[model samples]
Target chain A: MQTVSIDVGDDGTLSAVLRGELDFTQAARIVAAMEAAIDDCRPDSVRVDLAEVTFLDSSGIGALVRAMKAADQVNASFVVERPTLVVFDQLNTAGLVDVFGLRRA
Target chain B: MIPETDSGYLQRLAELEARVDQARLSPEILSERAAGLLAGRIGCRIDEAHAHLRLLAGQQNTSVASVAATVIGALEIRRSTSLRQVRHSVEEALRATDQEPDQPVRVSAPDASYSWLDVVQQMLNALPGKHIVVVPVRGDDGRITDYECVAVSPGMRDLSGRTGPQLIGMAISTAYPDIVGGPVWRAWADSLTDGHPRSVEPFTYVHIDNGDASEHLLTVRVRPVGPGLLNSWVMHDEQTRLAERIDQTERLGNLGYGEWDLITDTTVWSDGLYRIYERDPADGPLPRAESEALGLPEDEPLRRQAAEEFGRGETIDLTTRALINGKVKHLRAVIDTVRDAEGRPRKVYGIIQDVTARETSRRKLAEVERQLHEHQQDLAAEHRLAAQLQHIVLPIPETPVDLPGLRAAVRYLPAEQASRIGGDWFHAALAGDGSVVLAVGDVAGHGVQAAATMAQLRHTMAALTMTTTSQPAELLAHLNRLLLALGVSTAPATAVIVRWEPATHACTWSQAGHPPPLHARAGVAVELPRPAGPLLGGLAHAEYGTNSLDLAAGDILLLYTDGLVEHRERTLSEGTAPVADLMSRVTAERRDYPLDVLLAGLQRANPDDDTCLLAVRRTDCGNGHD
Candidate 1:
């Protein structure tokens, strides 16, 4: 599988491009790498892009939620952008949509 | 024998005699005194006179000397005193008689009594009513019962013309047999059998229409007096009365009502509600904390719901499972919130009911639903497995084969329902000798086991027929053996096999407890003959009979599993007739249609079951067709 990538803008806004599946196998690595970069770069706001995400699960949502909370601890803004309908519905039902500032495409 | 002495001596003698009469001295003391006195007077031995005197004293109530003195000296004085006392009593009585001349006086006597009858008669005659008549009933067994009859003051006998024979000597039961046969009589009889009284006050008495019947629709009061004598009295034109109110206080008070104040954190419970909660209502209302604590731990969600309703100022009617007295109960409560003018919650009121029985029934219903769901799931899983097994056992042939004179196509339609997916199979394989071996079989039931049996039978038939020349009878016999053996040891299968020979232009077929295939030629269809045999596996020693048909060129033969033509709701003949009609129509319309197309058409013909059609046609050599 190809590695998913993340980019940070000059204005301290971070963006992640997720590819393949955000299933169990990839959620942990994505969360860890994005979190480490957020800590090092000290971005003011972060957005995770899920346009490339083929599959998403409860674990994926948990990783995102954890990352959001971790960002909050550091006083950085957190958001998820362009999640699929299925993932969005699951997160909405589980009451994690507002916590992560999730939005549908 | 008079004592000639002074009056004082005489008085002293009298005092001594009175003392002797009053005291209970022993016989010896009497003898001692008598000896002293009579020692000189009586010349015989004093002991003999003393014995005789003691015997006499014992008979009388005084000492022997006192008796002797009374007989000799005091007798005259006692008679005189008695005479004087009698004269004084007579004088008093005469004076009372002078005051009331009609009064009678009698001399009193002891040790005797008047009879009960006399006393009862006196009591009855002394009452102030002149119209009272008392009749005493005497049973043959010597049991006496009394009844009173009161006539209308002057005796209405003149108006009635008839005498009182009907009123007297008649048992109440005999007079009113309807009353005796009614439920009241049975109840009264039970009470009386327990030796208690049952009274019917102001009941209507229907007097038989007799000449001059003045008492004809009288109100009668009845009471059982003694054994079999029912006291019945007739009242003229009495107003009837009845109880006005019925008792239902217990039913109304059974369930309790309650209210909870969220703002004040207070709860008010009715007496019955407290009792329902198994708490004493006398001890104020239960603290809200304690009341919630007493509920089952599992009911915390319901408590939260009730709290939410109170917050929203909404009424909540809910039922929850509770534990009361260490036993699980279903409690039903209808809760309503009283709201303030600003739409704020004031208090939550509810009616709490113990619905343990209803909850138990609901639990049982849920349990039954769960069981039914589990059973359905199990059956569906079994069906899936069976379908898979059937797929593995009798897989569809990838290609059609060229038999000597017949071109054959076979299709197998599985059950429509997911839970009925099972052993329905069709086989069309070319024999080693260039003959066609076609077979279709259905195992009885629909499930994993049936599918497995179908697979086994189909595989065994293929293997057995491979070793022998393709003879329909021989192949069926082998299939029958396998089926019978498997059935005896396990589940069995039903099948039909067709063998076609191009050289002879004839088709030989045998049936083993399977529906016969349809033979259609020139748009005319008929069921092929079935061989004689019992269903495979039903009997240990059984063989299927064979049937044959000569194939004319352009003729079509159809073989199928019975699922295509049998349904649970319809008989075999009913299901087969429709399929046969469809086959006739389809072939007549398009005899030249491809085998696959024909099979698809047949599937369309019956949509309920998985349908299979094996259509075979022998090419005709006439008119240079071949």
Candidate 2:
């Protein structure tokens, strides 16, 4: 029931803003949404805005790994943009914050 | 032995014989006691109860048990819980809808050891005009509490001749206040508690008809059904038989018959309708709006749909839920309209039924199904994650990895079990001394921990090859000491390393508890002679020695993890035979297929373990695919 908005840049960069919890169920739903955006925009770089994610678990980590892999297959760059402190800590715990290119707001 | 026999020996022999007699009882005695109890309960001869016991055993999916204690858990649960759990009789009764078209309908004796629910359903269908109900009597503190109406037949009416849709959850005390604290209540409660049927003699009871009192003779029958009581009543009079017929039909199906005049907003309800609403006859029927208010807030959309259909004067059938007396009940109703000549609604007639029992059971079944589906999804996710991790860490080379004088190809297969997350790895690289160092190793155990150990060993070994010489024996000896220094005795490893020099066509290899490498030449293949050495991480002081084998042109060498050749039933020699034969055959065939195909064809798919194979061959330069 939370909302996600995506914008595409001329250089094939997809900027997505996500709101609400990224728990297991919501993580699974976003995986499909991200896949659709990637397919439609064919973006070379994806920046995800997780500033509004109040909760995140292993499922969110899995989603990030999957997004990174999908971007790799398409030769695109994947970056985490404007992540909340909780989201940054979660990615760090999974040892993938650097792999996912998390950036400060 | 006979010559040594004495008086004490004889006495000891007698004691031993007595002890044997006191041991376990014979199976036959246990079965007989069980059959006796069953016979008494089922009202059948001992032999028939024994037969029923066997059928009950089969139905419960239990092998078998003794006579007395062999009551199926379902029966015990029904006896102890007052019929809250699913009962054998209930399952059979529910099957009435699926009964064969040709099956004859009959009501058997209550004690016949037959499917009572099936018989009840058939009988209820046969005589829809008859009023019947099964009630559970709960007693505590040495007194009979009120009865809960678990089931009801069509057309059951109260003293006021008003009908209720469902009596399943209604307390008998509320609906039949005249009978509470009376002789009939005592007889029914005692019958249920004692597990015996008792009859009530015909008695005169005063009935109020339209505010007028008259005496009527009533005969009541009560029969025990497990821990519940089944009741049947008859008024010994012919005058109201016509009205009683309609009430009987509605009572059997938990239906309410009612009519509403749209113009006056007046509602006339049968006794069944009052029961559905959990209301008192003294309070007159609820107006249309008050009746609609019984539904939960979420059911407003359904209320709106019904209103729109009514406005259009359309016949409507709706199934919804309502909170009556603070208890949620499923309510289904069918409505038809009498329109004036101008096509405006005039009068509405409806039949309502309560279906909460069926709905509750359905929701429980759905919850169980959802849990099972989620379990399967978790397993699939685990499997996918393991494969993804393997792809990240290993990522086998795309094609032949060209070394000094040899071109090597690798084949890797993961364990088929979804949980097999081990570290099975292989390494091939050119050393500083210009010799190609090839290695294959497996870490003990499985899961993320094993994989981590594997990564540590591989990266450490790769770093060591650059710093140390390409001498197979010296390198293995150092690796063994490192394993001991690391204190990983519990997580041991097996590895085979080969150092090949292109100019001399010579190979020096050392193995640490690994199967010796296989060598194929011309039309034959055989395992290379093994050098002496204990497994690495097995002991601190174990020494390793190198062995040399001359490489010939057109020869293929293979080093593999044990999974490639291990089988539960096959001996080491027997398991390795296929790989040896496959190499010779594939090398002989030459042009028919690629080496990858031959390697794949040679491996038997073993789901229990994983395998990693590195096949290296010295190829003469300037020769392509052929």
Candidate 3:
């Protein structure tokens, strides 16, 4: 299982940083927490930071896609940030790079 | 358990114990008795006999008393005049070793005890090489002239190779004409006159016969005693070279060879053998028991096997480990038995070598190679299991599905990687509401985890469809709630559910973040607008709307996942061309293409993803009746 920490910035940019494996085993738990964080904070913009995540499989990628869909439902702009090399490679393979605005910064 | 002793039994036990104590003889007392008997038989002083016995006891690594006891046993057995026959019989009885403490100390023959002539004969026999006693013959004037051959050992061979009794009564002049006035004759006169030992380092002798001559070099030692002279000789060239060569080979190859006489309990170890075992020559070579004890605990099986082979008189080749000087060494040995006429093992000869470095490194390399092979096998097994799971969870019906209310077909293609058995599945059955529920879903991800989630969702929806209503929009909404309840929010899935009523030929369907269902009519294909809904497990309390229409004959509905039409390098519009073109060709040509053919033609077969395709066609009333 992985833990998700959400920070609501002064500029209303809510960030949910995931730590630990984001594979199928931890996907459901991590995604639900991210959804809850978005609903409660209701920030104008959201940043999903995967800097501490050592692994992320396709199920984890699905969770990211789900988070984006849910963010759209709440009228929030979603930006994915600081994905590790492995997660970035998988995301690039799925051709979701520009769609999620994934960047090193 | 032993019973307690009564007073009478205890008294008797003590008396018997005292009798045993009185019967035991102290070392000095036993030595004195043996020495007195030896001195009386050999006619020597008892103190001289004791000193000789003590010296032999030290060399043989035994107590003086035991050596004395053995001497007494030999003398008592020697009542028979034939020395060789008596010695052999005594050795055989000693091999049984019942209550005998001095059996091992009898390895070497003790000097026979007798008078001067007998002592002289014993000394002659004791010399290691060929030797004979020559008594000088003198004229009335007492000048030494010729020598008489009084006694000879079998080892003393003349130029003609005559030995033993043949040369015993012969004169030296008859055997060797040139031997008179020779240097050997001078030595004989000097030894007899002075009664002291004399030696010539290298004496050259020539043999002349039929005009052929050969010279030989021999070192001679002569000692005068009583009325004759004792002599021994050694060759200067051939014998020394042969022995040195054999010694050279043994040391260089780390090889040792030895012989053990079972009857005498006497073992002989070559110098190489002594070096190989790191043994001190002073302590003497190992006896059978000491050598057997050197094996490590794990070598017990090898020892047992070798013993079994030895009993059969078969040669044994054994390799075993031994702890030597705090290091483990591998010892390889080949043993062969030398049996007597009666088929008993009289002696055993063995060749042994140390092969520790080669064997240890080979074992380690084999261990590493075995581990690498097992690791590769483990990976192959895991892949096979994952591939098996894919087939178990997502089973597609053959050709066309013949359900109660509809004729349908389903196809599922998994990712090419054996370990990536993906989750692409479908379910179709007649519901209790008299309508058929048709569904297709693709769970996100691959492998066991994805397959597990897909099975849960399919089973749950099947249960709901069997007992509950068969409505499209309501079913999608319920499934969305089910996903949230199951806590599968991380793995979103796309699905389309259809409810077909056979009574009115009406069909209604809805989607959950899935592509729109395709409707084909009379050679034309059009994508139906998807109902308003989000992907499952993403949004809570998400809404879904459905569109219903009455279907006539010759109409087809196709539902599929994104894998059936999407490619990474192309736009969505362009990727849809294959499906559209295949659909138009199938319907327009009236080619009577099976639903499987249409699906195979449309699917792009991506190696990185899974695909599911389901198709249903409205049948004519007459065809349905058939």
Q: Pick the lDDT winner.
A: 3
The interface root-mean-square deviations, each candidate in sequence, come to: 26.0, 19.7, 8.0
DockQ of candidate 1, scored on C-alphas against the true complex (2 decimals): 0.01
Candidate of highest TM-score:
3
Interface RMSD of 2: 19.7
Candidate 2 lDDT, tens digit per residue, B177-200? 567877788898688667777778
Better of 1 and 2 by lDDT: 2
Output per-candidate TM-scores for chain A, rounded to 2 decimals.
0.87, 0.87, 0.89
- Ten consecutive residues with minimal summed lDDT in candidate 3 chain A? A89-98
Candidate 2 Cα errors over 4 Å, as ranges: A1-105, B1-291, B310-315, B323-330, B335-389, B413-423, B432-435, B443-457, B468-494, B501-513, B529-555, B585-601, B605-610, B618-626
lDDT scores of the candidates, listed in order: 0.57, 0.66, 0.71
Per-residue lDDT of A1-105 in model 3, one digit per residue for the tens?
A: 436888899998888888886765566777687788888878888889888876555567687877776677688999888876666654543445556687532
- Candidate 3 pairs with clashing backbones: none
Worst lDDT run of 10 residues, candidate 1 chain B, spans B106-115
Q: Score residue B573 of candidate 1 by CA lDDT.
A: 61
Query: What DockQ score does model 2 reach against the true complex?
Result: 0.01
Cα distance off (Å), candidate 3, residue B362: 7.6
